[model samples]
Target: MANVVVLLLSSYTSRLATSVLLFISVAHTQNTVVFQPSFLTATGPKTAALLLGNTSDISLYLRTVSPSSETGSIGPPSCVAEVTQWVLTREQVGKSAVRVRLSLDKNLRLCGQNETDADCCPKPLCVLETLQVSACVGGTPQASLLIQATIHALLVPSTAGSDNKTVIPNQVYQTLGSCPCDLTFGACDVRCCCDKDCSTETLKLFASHCLLGPFGGQVSPAPDYQCSVQSAEDSSDWFPFLCVQSPPENNPYLGLFYQGKTIATKRGPSFQRPILSAPLPDNVYLQGSPIFTVNDRYFTIPQKVLGRCVTNAPVAFLKNFEVECVTLLHSCPAGAPLQTLPKDLTVKVKNGQGGDAEVDVIEEVATDLSRFISSTDAVASSDERLACENVTLALDYKFYWKGNSITRISVTRTVGTISLNVALTTRYSAVFLNGEFAGEPNSGNPGYQVGLPVIAGIVDMLENDTGSIQRTSINLWKPVGDGFCSTAEKKPVLFGENSTSGCLLPVSGQNLTQCDLLRETVTSLQAALITATYVAKSGNPDYLTMTDWVNISYVTLNSSTSMDNNTSSCYGIPSHQHIHVWSLITSTVDGIPQRDIRAVQVSYSPSTWALDCGGGDVSSCVDPMETQLFPITSSVTFTDIPINTGPPKTRFQINFTEYDCNRNDVCWPELAFPITKYYTGEPYSQSLAKGLILVFFFVTASILGTPWRQIRQAWSCAAL
Candidate 1:
């Protein structure tokens, strides 16, 4: 899961000015998902209710629960009360479900206690925070979930158990299933929970088009909604990539530890090889070119889609941010109150576009953020929605306490002036038990026995196809592929060779050779993975001269003999397994020449699922391993590039030719080549004569009842 996410992110992010900020909003129940018409207008202080239903067969106990302040709310919401008289009482012991009513505390005010204060409050926008809850099965720590919650006075309090509905955002809805389409066929009713846009026509269109149509099967390109994200003044801020948090001074991957790795570039500062590796205390090798941000320019403003209600409403962007101060309160403690960092954070927001202030980092704002309020009316109408723009970034700081040393630096990103990077900073509480920064684990095993070949193939995606500039990783698994780094070992095929691990895709062995990941082509995948890296490695400043595409066969096992269905391993599994991959990078800027980047075409027959159970029957196949990439071939190109001034405006396009993997998409396949159940360290015979000898030996062993132990010994002796 982690590796896939990282690869998908890193692969598609080359054209981005910076890396994307990955904010994982974990969902609890069907109720905790993203829903449509997500934004709700709040006129004033109001009550919001949440009803949690546990479908587990056993009694479930609700323990600690609350809304984390990461939502950027003006005040803390007490789960106990909706009004003066009523409190959240249903959250008692041993109940399958419970209803909790939340309301602003009597003393809790959106604006400061003092009305004249400049930091009273910023213009209000409907913020979707999380409803964090801890549940226990029979009081034995079951699990915790973060349910999505929107705080607004005008929101219709969702009745719990509302047909087990969720507020999945439009994207999430499409990902989960076709909304109105599924709803029409009764396959699902996800749209019923959407911000109630269901008209008679919408329903009819959904049914006729989705279910009852001749062109129905599932929409090709999923539908998009008026979804929006918070806007930052600069694209870099919103899509955090770089970092003030210096790379590991001892890590060799970033060339930081390579004391003499400084390579002089044609223009600008000296550069070094940006590859992932550990430091070598003895010596170092360096010199690789990469694209760095010559300059930065702000892009689209961040926003939260408010449906068609405020479709044409004015969108605001942050002009600049100010951090009055950053305080070191106390040592970390479990469940202690969160004393907000960056003593006073404020944003100077403006309507429409904002000017570039050569934005980097600022210490203090003119006034406190609480005082950064817009002139929008105190009352919000259904159509008149507020675009509460907040640009959150990261900043590094160190504090000394009474002559003592502070080695590990604690990080913060919410509010205040701070340096931002792609790393996941602290979100909500530090306690993992409360489901803080919670996420779904990527651990699934299918029955098709896809084996390790597909796993290796997937891991190949994490190769060091680094662009000149690299984004810091924030996903749960940052050092992507760390999970598989040493998960398995590859035995040496030749007698004198040593076994190697972590080389699943390349399938490390004496046979593994320098078949360059980039096969010198005009369009190749590895280059697209790191366009900047490709630019540097290409050695051509103006033109990427690896002209013309190359036709390369699917990477094979590097074996002398090709074992097919005609032959099988001792375990009755096919010795030779094939995985098809074709990744190409090609692009043309309208005004610029098209002599940059490279491409490689890979062709191979789609493999079949190595079913372990039944005789590979489609129905009997439990967990199917995909034998081919849906798009057996894929390409990415950057177009309409503005090279001169202004930020590089690149149109990134991916030509994906989909194919059937093992039939359905339910099963995910990994690389299992170069890996066999048994290790013989003996190469196969290429000639028919040698092949016959090998076949005769196997047949003789089987007929004479020769054990595996004796067979291995005989093979070893023959090698000797």
Candidate 2:
């Protein structure tokens, strides 16, 4: 399984409003303080607000506490509010007052569940309430303030017509009875679950658990999506498949498109509905009759604990039965498409059982393959191999239909358990293969070979074998555990084993059969791609550039590769890099050169393979070449000795060319390419010539400094 990295994002809201400060005083420089705007009028056009900011680097959070009930019952005393993320340093907000919006959604979830009550939300009571805002910096609350507000009730349709005589509206708690569905539009929550006209049982179920409440939005009337599911003022009616389903691990909250119509379900009270009535997402295909939903005996929704705190945010752990499906037998009404045993599928059956025979067959794989793939705990030598069973299972419902009547007799499938074993071969294979051992140089059919250190050689060759059997050609089913089932990218691969090394699965689930060696090696390459950044100083700009030094070897840049010199390419601040043609194929057929095969080989003999470490008799180190070549490949290439040029030069330096004005329009700053350099300046021959000339001048000056004594005497006589 690939190690997945997940990032979570949090959101907070702020509003701009005028300041309304009450008579209050506090010490300056204190970490805790409150902003202005204290009271809110529900009936007034302008709303009350409290704004906070100005803590330069500290993260500020304001947690709200509702007033106690003794104070004329603070409206919605159970209501609470908080700011999840307020990092004051990043975004600049001046001292001006900024309103902090105080509101909660209809979930009425005080915490994470949906336990509702009068105090669960801010009831529009227009009562004097104390809204206390506590300011915290760096998670420590330094101060708190009480903001007094006169709240007015917002008349919502759900409570607008409630009987005031009975504080608890009977309409708020009513029973839901069976009613016809909005066949054209699908289902209507208001007509059924929240229907004020419904029975007490129905409304109680709706209020307590039904997720379907109301839908209010502009509807585009069209032939395809024309849904006239009755407006709020219309007559009371019920709809099928409108109630909520709560399977322990199955969150039926996510709705789906059923048949042609979309029957969306929510997390609501079951109201004694059958589990088979729950709709599965589109991914799950049912081969049996639609009437199979009537089989309540087998597909029943189990009772679960309730009063779960709900929220608008998706419940990450909320179990979804979206793709879970089961096939059951049912007789369809006449005029149905002829039902016959699915030819593409099969079923296990018990035959010749006198009257009628029925059998069920299924295939289930391991729930979590990673559990069996590896163990950090040491196992006894005898218990090296492990098998995780029931990772995948297939159950088919095969029905034979004569006319409209259907008959499902048999269906069976087996899940083959994948068994993985770890064994220490202790130098199981040789790394070296000379011409003789490889059976003649250039002897194989349309063949190619790369020379490398024994370890690299094995990898490059095994890579070929892995390619020979295309990994993509073989389809691997996504495993069950340690992964998301919806997408393959999120699903766990290779049985949840993060690393495949020292792991081996039995070939075709057979104990005697060993897995393909090449496959095992290939599968182990699941670690993250390692990235390295290299920088090298230039010796001579004209002839030098950085090279890749990995595995203690310098991978040279191709001769034709040139370092970039376009400064304008990066906003007049140019960057450069070294690149080369990297390939691994020797040659091709039909007079074509195969993919370029680039290889570096390090070789040595450990035992009897070659001279055997000064060759005496015979000894071996995993065929001798392995352990010997391994160290050489990893230790030899780093050279303190400079890459020599034709001859030594007097002076040189890596130079950077500036961008001319003409390039400004064509530039875009993208990658921060490394500043690469190559050799530069005068040739060694020119410097040597200049040095010789200087030497000749120095000799001439020395000779001229004192003329020969005879020459001096002759000059004196001539003068006389």
Candidate 3:
């Protein structure tokens, strides 16, 4: 009986243990598993919602629990919650067994007994600890299913920040402050009027005045509001009180709000001004401002667009510029108004009355268009076949200005008529002149400065005209690939640059008369190559004497040589010419340096070579009708004569002394010696003698004042 009783007790104990384990498993499953989302999403700043599985014949309830509450009891009623039936369409409910929707207020209240103790809720105010879903059957209350979770509802602050009264609005005012350029610390900054470090006495002693006034340079004067008021009063139906005030209110709301706890915006890498299609005109133009036009747009000229002419190239104020481009013009019939080069050009000027006025100062220019017509047979025929083509050859603009404002403008156009589809070269140049005092550019005061063109002219020494000298410029070889040389475009030679150029001369004739004409033409062209017989040393010739002029030496071309040669071969064809210029630099007794041209020598190659037909001696003459090509070249070289100017005028010179290491390999010891020396009242030898005497006295006192008896007694004790 005892054994059976023991077995029954053990069995009962095992059964009890099994039941406890099963209960624990069920509770763990309930707490760990949840059908709803883990977090509640915010729909608004203070409103949140959760999505979960839905079921019919079930009612749901929600409650908040403080994370710090250990007893699993409900904390303060911080948030309210509600549930709504969610209906999902077929597409949304595909293979889904549950649908859910629930909402909660994000503005949770804190647990405090009195209003004074109430404070802002924590970051995550309440946690949805448990969701009670009660299932009913046929109107009878049934068992409830508890879905345990640790979901948190975030307390999002409102973007408007209505509760925060001390928050400042995000706004920028254009008020002047202290000088922005005053970077120095604890010291007065030069030209900084608003610098607090600058005292009244120090400011008075400034060498230069402040560029910006007491206010910083960033501030501009407020526009005149009285002008608008007066204009409104002048109107028939307007009143002064009805005009809107220009000043801003003391507490104007900008309607800007913070989106989150921190207020910040992502900045761009670089800053660029906003571009406008047509810029508005301003009363006054600052530095680098675009030039204004009459049509409320920036002034622009036709510039090269992909190697072709296109309009609307903007120009800046106070800038001198020039551009050369090839342009095409549409056919203008015989009697149509010659297409003015610049179709739309009028400048707007400030009239000093708070308004802009248009000025038609651009003078209308007309040129003889017939002079550009091609004389070739093919071009002549093509010109008749097509309509007349008018083109602008050049456009020159002269702007007269007084103190940052343009007062007048002068435009001159050089136009010409040409054949169809012919590319025309157009030159555009602009210059700014001072309206107050307009004067020509000076080469120098008393001596010619470097880089100025040489003052030269031709002397026509004829039997009747002895003193008839015409002012002429140096010529450069310009070839257009027509097998002949041309000087249509003359480019002047500047000083100090040595240059050489050449062109092909075509000699063609059928008989003696044509040959003679060709020879004369060649002779005339060669003679005109170096027509300047004399050149002034300086730009101002009024104070120049006969010695100040430099005469050019060259071989005179005799026109009788070609006539004397009866042969068909052409003679006296100038092959090459060289110009040698010498410069002399000298100084006056007062040490003023001057530059003058010392000598000018012009030499030509031998002109004895004859061009004979049916021979390839100098140049190929394969065809009788074909033109014979002869090469013509010219060169100019400059040489400075070696002359003593004067003594050096430099006031300061520095020399560094170093030990010569190459003279001796053991020079490091000398270099290592210290340079600083200590000086005494007496000489070096006397100071050395005095230092030795002090050293001897100190040694004698240390040697004679010794304790010898104590030392002997200590030694005897050590021996014992």
Q: Pick by TM-score: which candidate is best?
A: 3
Return the TM-score for each candidate structure.
0.15, 0.17, 0.38
lDDT (Cα, 0-100) at 239 in candidate 1: 31
lDDT value, residue 12 of candidate 2 = 21
If ranked by lDDT, best first, what sequence of candidates would result? 3, 2, 1
Model 1, 1-720: lDDT tens per residue?
Answer: 111111001111112222233333323453231211122222223322222334343232222234436985433222231222112233322233343333333222244234674422323333334443333444443334333434332323345454766766444223334333333543334334331345565656554233421123222322111011111111233232332223223222321123355555454434653544655422111111111111321122122243211111221121111122222212221221122233321222121112211112233322243432212244545444422223332232221111111111122334332211111122221111112221111111211011111111111122466222221100010112333312322221111112221212212211112122212221232122212211111112212122221222344323444334311111111212221222222322211223222222222222222223335544323222322111112222122223443544334212321222344553223132123212234321123336577779888878677586688789999999
Candidate 3: which stretches are off by over 4 Å? 1-325, 328-343, 348-368, 371-407, 412-452, 457-472, 509-519, 531-533, 539-549, 554-571, 587-594, 612-625, 645-720
lDDT for each residue of candidate 3 in 1-720, tens digit (9 for 90 to 100): 111100000011101321111111111121122232233332222221222222343343444333445676533322233342212111122221233333332334433334453233343434334444333334333333333433333434445455756644342433333357577889888877667888998878763466543234423332223323342222333334354456523224222232233535455545554443553435455434666655556666555656665556665556566666653433543421234534444556452223454534344334654433423234445444464544455667776666556667667766555556444445676676786444233344556666766667655565764444445556555554463676333455566678777677665434322655665665666566666778766555432244556677776556565445543465555667777878777542112456677777877664644446544353334434545567777777878888854665333212212334445555553442222123345433445557678779988866565665567778899999
Candidate 1 regions off by >4 Å? 1-359, 362-541, 544-605, 614-720
**Candidate 2's residue-wise lDDT over 1-720, tens digit each?**
222212111112222234433443323343434444333332221233334333443333434446456884434212234542211212323442233444433222232235446443354443443445444555555434344444344443543564658344222222121132322344344435433355675566545344332221111111211122322212233321242333322422222222345456566678966567544332121222122222211221111124221111121111211122221112221221111223422322212121222433343343543433332334434443454333222232333432232234334432334433421110001111122221111212333222211111111224345311101110122323332212222121111122211111111112112223322322222111111122111111111112211121234324353323221111111011112212333434422333321322222211111122345533332242222210100112211222243555334212311232224443223121121112124433345456678779988877676665567788999999
TM-score of model 1 (CA atoms) = 0.15
RMSD of each: 35.0, 34.4, 30.2
TM-score of 2: 0.17
Worst 10 residues of 2 by lDDT: 423-432
Looking at model 1, how many pairs of residues clash?
Answer: 44
Local distance difference test scores for all models: 0.27, 0.29, 0.49
